[model samples]
Target: MGRLPEAPLLLLVVTVSFLTGPDVHAGKILVFPVDGSHWVNMNLLIQNLHAKGHEVTVVRTATSWYVKEHAPHYRSITVTLPQAIVIEEEEFFVNFLMKMLEIKKEGVSPIGFMKFYWEMLNALSNIHQQASRLGVEILENRTLLQSIRDSRFDVVLLDPGLPVGVLVAHELKLPTVFNVRWITSGEGHFVVAPSPTSYVPTSGFAATDKMCFSERVKNMLFYFLNTCIDKLVVCPHYDRLVDKYFGPDVKFYHLLQGADIWLMRVDFVFEFPRPTMPNVAYIGGFQCKPSIPLSPELEEFVQSSGDHGFILMSLGTLVKGLPTEITSEIAAAFAQLPQKVIWRHTGERPGNLGNNTLLVKWMPQNDLLGHPKVKAFVAHGGTNGVYESIYHGVPVIGIPLLFDQFENVLRLEARGAARAVDATALTRQNFLEAVQDVLHNPSYRSNMRRLSALHRDQPLRPLDTAVYWIEFVMRHKGAAHLRTESYKMPWYSYYSVDVCCFLLAVLLILKAAVVGSVWFVCFRLCRRRKPKQE
Candidate 1:
């Protein structure tokens, strides 16, 4: 009876200890995100952070197409811009897609290639210049700047594609974590990591790591163009802003390269083997989840497909519909297939709509992909969709358009899990042929299933990994130990050009000394012999 009383006392003590355990540390976070599809990825990350008890403040432009001014997850600091950037306009992208399709229809001609890239470069320049204006606006607002300073943010999380947050972080003297895939120059890896031209294919080039002589030459050319774009298109706008705000000598690219961590949205299962940096953490498919039961209407449709199954089609958040001509062709092709189709399209209906195809403004993409009835996916090769398809183990019929889509499709095609059709050259017959190949061939499904297994076999979910690293930065102040100091060195020093020159000079001096010694000895011998003769 005395021991029973002691046991109750011990239990109360344990409960008190559990209740008094340390709470999660809530860090102050500031965010500058690029609007539109990029926002989709950023929003999910913000939600996770908020759940972890972090206080997040997001900076949005007044003309933002996607980011709302008020959100339950984060506080907003909206800056007013003169106008939205070119990339923000939906109509501009639609028209741009049409132009690219026209250029791409001509196949692999130098003229056609140049035309396509030239248009891209011009559009890129305009977007960067306009984005710079946002940075300028933020810096000029003294009140806004003071509030950000007073908040004492732990880290500035940003998308470096536009890099408005980079500027703000520099001004505030805070560490940064980049949620990045693309940067101003090109792919984010090129900004800090070792990318050899012999194997590392440039973005938008449809070549894999294993390239022939001609493909290698083509890759080099694309790399050269990327360099020109960085210098001509990227540097001028950001450099001026950096100079104006941060002082005269601060290089914008160096500031860009000096981030604390990079949470790259790709993994080996989806990406080819390449050299990466310690600071870069691969978190591909972080946004994916197991399927939920669909709505009754959608469930009925899936059941109705019966033994034939159904194919899912979505061109991502952007590109709701292709041109009428292209859509009509696609619809005509779908008519011949026995498999039911659920296509996400907007605007006018295609002239040649098929009875087997169901058109909707939007569908639950992830849930639909996870469904057992999903036989195949027709996607425009966006990173999010590609990862989702990989997560679900669904084979793809790729209809690529715009930046990086071509390269993305090529990777899948090389792996034998997907078939790529030229969006510009797609006719009913060729498009139908590609679909039939993927549907009938068991290899595609098996390969994708293998990839899905590899992706899912990780010890921690990708999202958890990303969050751990981010909180790691918050805990330790910054991840300077993982970051390389190569960004601070000049190009000549970083490339070891100075070291190479010094070694060459030392060798030349040694060679000269040896020659001089030989010549002197021969002369002395000749003179001594002549003296003996005299």
Candidate 2:
């Protein structure tokens, strides 16, 4: 063959290098992930990271319901516990959901609200007490501890909701990255940023950013409740462990806030505009992608509905099914609709289930949402599902369960992209009205499409953005420059209470000196007045 020209020769070399060359970089990552729906998104990141030449190893509990023992994308290390956290049991969560639904039946009054949070406190306390044991178990195991130390893992990625990962990462002396939305304290921002309760509504408050005075009061009360949960229900579990291994001087929330990068699972598009930190990177909808072709059978089912499009419904990963009564009401409501329904549910079949509805133990929720024929989404307002609904421009009829789900749907409702139905007050009639309104409503779809456009009009894909930050931490060893030392400050210091007090004292002294000078000058100038009075 003739020798190529210089330009062509260079191009050929570049092409060859691109085709059969070494990866741009390969880094070792250690992950301590929360299971269930959280793991679903985490697994997506792991797959993408693996594709980009990173090696991932996950630390999971032996009793994990979703984090598999074997997977191609990552290796797993299972920690044995005396008992799987009581809250991890399927039965416990189902029963908890059922009871919460019952409590909510009285509606949004103070008595009903108190009953809900009281039950939440009980479950939240138990989950944290059990979850905090994972770090201790790892530390107690000499072999595991030594092995982890020897691995020289580049970074630790975790969900701070459970927060055991933060403790373990701190002990390992590795840079930490949080795949965060909720922290044990509440919303991740409350732990890591300057959140003003004046406008930034606390999770589950279901209030929007623009609030009246009374709404702000409720927001503060909700915030105070979250802080109490942290101090009373969540912190004590991790505090002793911090004292034992890390030292008493180390604050637990400080460890959480100190993560090198916070890959927040929400964007301003979905979340109300709030204060954020340099270390926090919003990567909402990172798990979303363009839909792929549906299976033949599924496609036929989807196409069966004529001009009236279908609605996809799912309660999320942990909720396999609702109580029979709720399901029956929902099913009856669906039966009244003209649109066909695909519900991802498993359990006793609803007696009133309509011919127009299809129930499955599982469904491709994301792909189905992206389908052109999907008219609306009936969901429990999970973060993942909500984001997918936005990404695909599908309006939502939200059935919020607990823990930020309410807030998620409330945001969509605020945007005119969704509607929320109180599960406690759920009835066939009410549910049917909400669904029909969403279906017929042109505003909902247009609003969601606009959100989808805004969400998509970014310089970088959210997933790639997340991967870049994760790799950014790995390359630098730590992102200390981006992290805030504010987490280490006392509350008074953090809020500048001391500075305010000092300034106030100086102002008072200046005023007092001026008053004294004026009095003295007046006495000197008007001395004859005092003599005349005598």
Question: What is the number of backbone collisions in each predicted candidate, taken in the order shown?
Answer: 0, 0
lDDT of 1 by residue, 1-534 (tens): 446688899999988977985433789999999887899999999999999899999988788888899999999998887878877778877888877777666556787788777887788888988899988887898987898899999999999989878888899988899998999878899897999989999976889899999999999998998888789887799999999888988888888999999999988887888899999999999998899999999989988999999999999887757888988999999998888999999968998998999999989999999999999999999999999999999999999888898888888888889999888888999999999999999999999999899999999999988888888888888999999998899889999999999999999999999999999999999989997899
TM-scores of all models?
Answer: 0.94, 0.93
Tens digits of per-residue lDDT for model 2 on 184-294? 877888888888989899866989999999999999998888788789888998988999987868888778778899999998899889888899999999999999999
For each candidate, the alpha-carbon lDDT, in order, equals: 0.89, 0.89
- Residue 67 shift from truth in candidate 2, angstroms: 0.5
Off by over 4 Å in 2: 1-24, 106-119, 521-534
Those runs of model 1 whose alpha carbons end farther than 4 Å from true positions after fitting are 1-24, 106-120, 531-534
- Output the number of the lDDT-best candidate: 1
Shift of residue 297 alpha carbon in model 1, Å: 0.6
Instruction: Using TM-score, give the best candidate's number.
Output: 1
